[model samples]
Target: MNLTPNRKEHREMSTIVSRVRAAYARIEAVARPEIWIDLRPQAEVESEARAIADRVTAGEQLPLAGRLFAAKGNIDVHGLPTTAGCPSYAYEPEADAPVVARLRAAGAIVLGSTNLDQFATGLVGTRSPYGAVRNAHDPARISGGSSAGSAVAVALGIVDFALGTDTAGSGRVPAAFNGIVGLKPTRGLVPTAGVVPACASIDCVTVFARTLPEAEQALSFMASPSARDLPPLPQRAPGPWRIAVPPRDQLGELDEGWAEAYEAAVEQLRSAGAEIRTLDLTPFTEAAAMLYQGAFVAERYTAVGSFVDKAIADGAADLDATVTGIITRARDLPAHQLYTDQDHLTALRTQALSELADADALLLPTTPGHPTLAEVAADPLGANARLGRFTNSTNLFDLAAVAVPSGKVNGLPFGVMLIGPTFTDDRLARIARDLEPSVQLAVVGAHLTGQPLNPQLLSLGARLDRTTTTAPVYRLHALATTPPKPGLVHVGEGGAEIETEVWRLPAEGLGRLLAALPRPMTLGSVQLADGTSIPGFLCEPAALENAEDITTYGGWRPYLGS
Candidate 1:
């Protein structure tokens, strides 16, 4: 998790490489060989590492210098086999996929090719012959796929980041389950040439990382206009922003834990000064239904149709029944129906575009809910379709998304996805990074400067806020609780200024801090003198019902010292 280097605290490139090498050694100690269909030899990886190190040492501003990452097996890595999770369908590529080549050019070392659900067909991680990928947080749970191994590799700290494909929820689902960040870029934003297509028109190369910053770093390196056959993307200006959230009716069978977590996440954003609004998701939901329920399934067949036909003719079909059935069904559709589906898709796109016009981004759950490996196996197709309820329309509508870890539900990770119109990738990443819980929580209580609790914040990647002040209307009360608790009360109209210090913590750290808080004290929105609000500590009304009002002393520290 401590993969990023401090921008101000410079270190030699060799040092970074050595740190990564040491981490990889640990991965090797518990190595699951089957999780990889093909791996770059140790010598080759080291050689690439050394070359990257040399470039960084020479003062080249390689944005991803000394970082190691992996690609899904379907993506062409020069000198490595492109198997698409099917050995019989394997072929040696003479060149790296355009996206991979770009990452390499930016100084990232390609560690190896990871496994996936066969041909990227299922959302569950068990369909691959290479092996079933286990959850990073809990081995018993499914890792979520077809980006299963890619998500696992990052969550387990095996690599700084990794690449996967997202036609459905292949990219975001895995990230959500594994507690990491998954970025499914706009179609054609990251070139897909040399990548085996699941549905070529919709397939997008995705990135996974432990944090949004790392994912954005990888994305910035990989996104570029292709020299050949790249489609056009929109250009928009940035300013006052509006974000759309799903109407309550569409939240979709969420568990209590997840519902609470999502609500808390939204409150956090509101506390950070973001204007949250509701949007009718009917258009998006309708378009998502068409991905598999309509003729778009035929696009997958069109991508691999000839290969499938030839393989079947040779008495060897290299496809899973579910995938074959989904693809073959497309053949039965008449040309007229296909055209009709396209026209319907066009209408949906128009409706979506109009709905999104007033907002800069759409916020929704990355997946409707999480399903265990056993649940997925019991009904593969149904469970997989459910996972894509929020994601299928993204690529089809030509939108980009960043799936960020919101928080945990009963110890299981959940995420919220931020979707935007094409070419807003940079803007979306910026907002997502800011919205992350850790970054927005302004610690001002026992965890302030030079206190015992300060180190806790530091350990969670918090930075000191130089300009700090307390709520002008608050009166501090010495609470009758453990850990020397304090209570803040709002004093209307006439109030005294209080002393407080603000410290910035990351999203992951904020969750830890909240979990550690004792009863009666909780995190809530605190308004400052200048009319700005941020996440801070507050006491339940019951806790302060009998407490004495001590507004005369100004703040807790002053009153406590007296």
Candidate 2:
């Protein structure tokens, strides 16, 4: 499921309804009941979409007019009951949570309410009485959770985007496992008033999308002014940014595949113009441990302990036993323990943030590795804890994070998270966008390595992916230009394979390159020798009328020597 941006437009009602129907068809095909605790009927959703379309036709500037989304059950949606992954605790909300309402006001329609770990307790998706939300990529593995269903919904393309909550990586872990983008904004940047709290003070309403821009777009509309007086954004000049990473020796026993993927991600970042710096993350890891292993566990109890206690007393509680133990055990903690832990955290947060003072963000593997359902079942606590080894600390320190896909490991998705200081949300987003899939562009002439105009591509941050040749169906012409430029034209009957180089650049850079291209040169699909086509340099037939035939020379470099 390649999740690309859905076109945001004032589309027709019929088109909107059709998209809704297609989504329903996809949902049926997926057959993952645990993903949704309460889904609106297809007809009902289509009807609302029609109304939204009507409003857009009336000249409403709804940015998300044609988009569809799902809300995590812990976040209130008007017609659905808030389950927080516990059926016995369900309750209907009077209106949508402020975050959901903002999205709806912008013309996005909600399809339903998705699942999560019960009480948002576990990092693994299995701690749900709604049944475990399986990974979108592989059912046998766990979908890293607390926000399990929301991430899976976006990954499966059932909806354009979905809402989730992140306290202890609920918003990030599932995205890494499912290959989607999770934007966890700085704490309190978005309101959590209507959400079922796990640790109310640090919990964030998160956005999950197939791409960073979409998640950023959602967050734009979702955010309201916060009382937290964040310092103005740093006045930094644009050039290569400094990015921090944990030293290789300190990364701690990563699965081989994940380690390789992390190293590749670092190189990718470096290629994208980041200066890599090694920093020990011992303090950061220690802060992450404090979230659950120390007095902070009491906050989770403070958030939902009474409800769980009451349910247990009534004998109507159908809860995950592990979640039960963690929350209940915190009930008797002395008040002084929280203050003591708070002091400890203040010291740790200061130390950890200082480590990133000179860097744009810290990049780390989102998790150690993918875990199988059986593996988690065999060692639930250890498996769940390990899943949060790289997450779980962001909000505790009031930081912002964006988790983006970083290739794959053993056919499963792997991802890396960029953590930045508080209020650096916009900055972090810009860096993360560069980490998304790069465009594969094939070039035949000037943009190739060691050519007159090659620097233009390099300036736009393009990296040569490979040097290959076109299928034996293209003719090469020496164009009459200020500087010698080659024109590639497809001639089915009498043509020769032409040398070409494929460069990978961020999608935004590709757009800029296309806009600045000269008239005689154009970009179109060029078939490679392997029978695959990618965007490559091409020319108008008219421009080649007075050009010299260079097919005999095979390539520009060879022709230059001749």
Q: How many backbone clashes does candidate 2 have?
A: 0
lDDT of 2 by residue, 311-362 (tens): 8899865888989989999888888988998999999899997888789999
Cα shift from native, residue 169, model 1 (Å) = 2.5
Regions of model 1 farther than 4 Å from truth:
1-17, 225-240, 313-318, 439-464, 468-562
* Candidate 2 residue runs with Cα over 4 Å from true position: 1-11, 441-524, 527-533, 536-562
Q: Report the Cα lDDT for candidate 2.
A: 0.87
Writing each residue's lDDT as its tens digit, candidate 1 over 372-405 gives 7787778888988888888889988988898988
- Write down the TM-score of every candidate: 0.76, 0.81
- Score candidate 2 by TM-score against the native: 0.81
Model 1, residue 433: distance off in Å is 2.3
State the weakest 10-residue window (summed lDDT) of model 2. 1-10
Where does the lowest 10-residue lDDT sum fall in candidate 1? 1-10
